[model samples]
Target: MEKKYPRLQIAKYVAADYFSAMVSWILFYTFRKKIIVAPLYDSVGQDLNDPTLIMGIVIIPLFWLLIYYLSGEYHNIYKKSRLQELGRTIFITTLGVIIIFFILILDDTIISYKNYYQSFLFLWGVHFSLTYLPRLIFTTRTIHKLHNHIIGFPTLIIGSDEQALQLYNDLQKKPKSAGNQIVGFVTINGGPKTPLSNHIPHLGNLNNLIETINNQKIEEVIIAIEPSEREKIQQILTKTKATNVMIKAIPDLLNILSGSVKMSSLFGVPLIELSHELMPAWQENVKRVMDVVLSSVALVVLSPFLLVLAIGVKLSSKGPVIYSHERVGRFGKLFNIYKFRSMYTDAEINGPALSSKNDPRVTPFGRMMRKMRFDELPQFYNVLKGDMSIVGPRPERQYYIQQIVDKAPYYLLLFKVRPGITSWGQVKFGYAENVEEMIERLNYDIIYLENMSIYIDLKIMIYTIKTIMEASGK
Candidate 1:
């Protein structure tokens, strides 16, 4: 089996973002101390020993991160446009600088109001330039790689008729034109034969579109069905909307001529909109960076605690210190999720079983760990691994997921995002004692999915902390 690459690629991008943000923060802090604030001096220099200055180094980066996240700068790393990213970065950085100035620098003992203004502008320039310059360099390289066909989204055409063939030819002839490199084509109906089979292999017929997309690592889908196939197109669109792939359809000539199509000249080819991006690209990048930095910090800061828990689990339970179990993740891929072993080694000897409040399989330490959510510390690694997020719907085994989907078809929507260590459902409802409670919690998870914003995520995190502190979790 070809290893699924999307999650891994996303993880890599997030890791890059974490490092980039760290560098930016360091640069900004250095600039603030040496250039921006240091100039506010008489013959006798201002006191350098103020704790606020030291604290600013820590607080500024956090504020920047929160601002970047709330502005939706960190949502989807893979599906970002360079122009969109730059616009968002500039906007968020400007806003963040203003906030920082008002909160920290404005009350400084400046020589004049002009000096204050100069200091604010200098800080903004240093931070924005430091941050955006690296991001632009990275994004530009990615775009160049994409345009040169060295790196491209794995795209599949969904129609096999004349239109699909035309699209395939257009894309193949101008590889750099579309940001997508066609891996192959999948036929939508038993209609006209496609002529591009010589260049692109036919993966399958229409009945297996979903399976083909999953198996082929397809990142984008172009629906080339004729206007007459409205019903079929609707069905395909409805089914595919749940998947995290970009969906586009060729508009009729009339619509194109009437200016319904928005075109962009990247490398000299007019590309049209497939669908509105789910999240802005820069926000996606920000989210990844946050995930990586927070996860890494949590792992390191909590290492002593994690070690103690591992030892406790080893002594308390007849099992390995860590438990690795298969759980469904983004786009329904299975990954071995790690957690501190919180149950007996043979807890699942009777096969998969959902834990209840008084399940005999849970050890005393395990129960405490579950209550405080200490068992989940190991999954910070999962967040770093990109198998999960720090915030999102909790992942479940296929056994439970299938059961949930039977009652709620929309359960699959949760798979569109990486499962989280703590979710709105986990925070609000705690662990489900049975399938019924699981379904009930699924409702909140679905709500979180629909109203997914950084603000909502922060709320979930706050509630999660409260739940953990109160030991209110089941």
Candidate 2:
């Protein structure tokens, strides 16, 4: 499926949905004109060719299309399930109906209150039927292709042990195809070899996993090692996390009985899907929107406050007011993060050090700025520049990050999100005075990642504000 006209495949979904919107709107308008509105006293004989009618036909469909795109309905078009598509379509269509009715049709001249409810129900029914039917047809075709072995995703197995061989054989012998066309397998530590190597070619060392993934265009990674090697799972993800490949693992009876496994494929096999995404697609997009809008407004609205702080920092210290430091961001990319100077010129001349409450390096005015959290204001520019977000695990310098990783290898997980100006860790545990303290704060950050949500972010922000107002930096 991915090999043939990949771009056109997604275009087909968009085209089908676009016409669905246009056709549904046309039917609803016709119903309103000929049945619902003609009985009204003033709305009789509404013109079908009016400028507004023509404009709406063009605009409404585009509006629906934008909504679908933002909802991420157009992504992974070939891999979608008809059942999931149906549910998503209903949800988005209902939202669309509410917006359209309020903005476009609430003021319409109607014979009675019944007309309002009737119009809404009619439009909603027409839209849902038209929209869902075509998508279901397209999705059905994709599924049929997969079952017939005409379409498959490139999958790589990450172990060569007994469990790997068992999974490989079961998948091959399954009556129905799961669409995982195995490209090859890799050994984690040259553990006891199995028939897996005889069946599929052994892709080289695990260290070369990324290169092999790119070269073979691997779409999936199935880890089938034993329970003792569970620690290796973290190492594999730390490397392959950047590849955007779907990762799954063979689950033991313990996991299945405990309801820890959420099945993704119902037919050929049962595996635990590893989804590390922090937010749903729509929420992720909205978070970026919030970051841009909020940062832009803060920079503009707080310009006076920022200017005064800049001069105060300059007079209190002999360093640039706006300090730029290189920090590791998402996917381990390094970028210069901006900050308002809160220390003397040679504060870090000896080496990188975490600040103590009474550190002499922090000038008197700098300490006050830290108390008010004013030192982080310049990072709004970083947020606007798309390098950081308003709420995420705080970023650390590479030297410090390396040390932190030594203590907590999962520290690298924080790199999954753009480092924020203030984080749940900063709010809950305050500043770290040493490596041990930083590791202690890591627990709160890990909690934030596991329970990430818009509401959680808002709560962290609220606590951060109260802390700043109280000059409560530790």
For candidate 1, which ten residues in a row score worst on lDDT?
Answer: 252-261
Write candidate 1's Cα lDDT for 139-233 as tens digits. 67666666666666788887776777777666667646445777777766563356757677888876677788888878887777666665575
For candidate 2, the per-residue lDDT at 102 reads 99
What's the TM-score of every candidate structure? Answer: 0.66, 0.80
| Candidate with best TM-score | 2
Give Cα distance to truth, residue 302, candidate 1, Å: 5.6
Task: Show the colliding residue pairs in model 2.
Answer: none
- How far is 107's C-alpha from truth in model 1 (Å)? 8.3
Tens-digit lDDT track for model 2 on 281-337?
Answer: 777777777888899999999999999999998888687988888998986778999
For model 2, where is the 10-residue window of minimal lDDT?
Answer: 253-262
lDDT (Cα atoms) of all candidates against the true structure:
0.72, 0.83
Per-model RMSD to reference: 7.1, 4.3
Instruction: Give the true-structure RMSD of model 1.
Output: 7.1
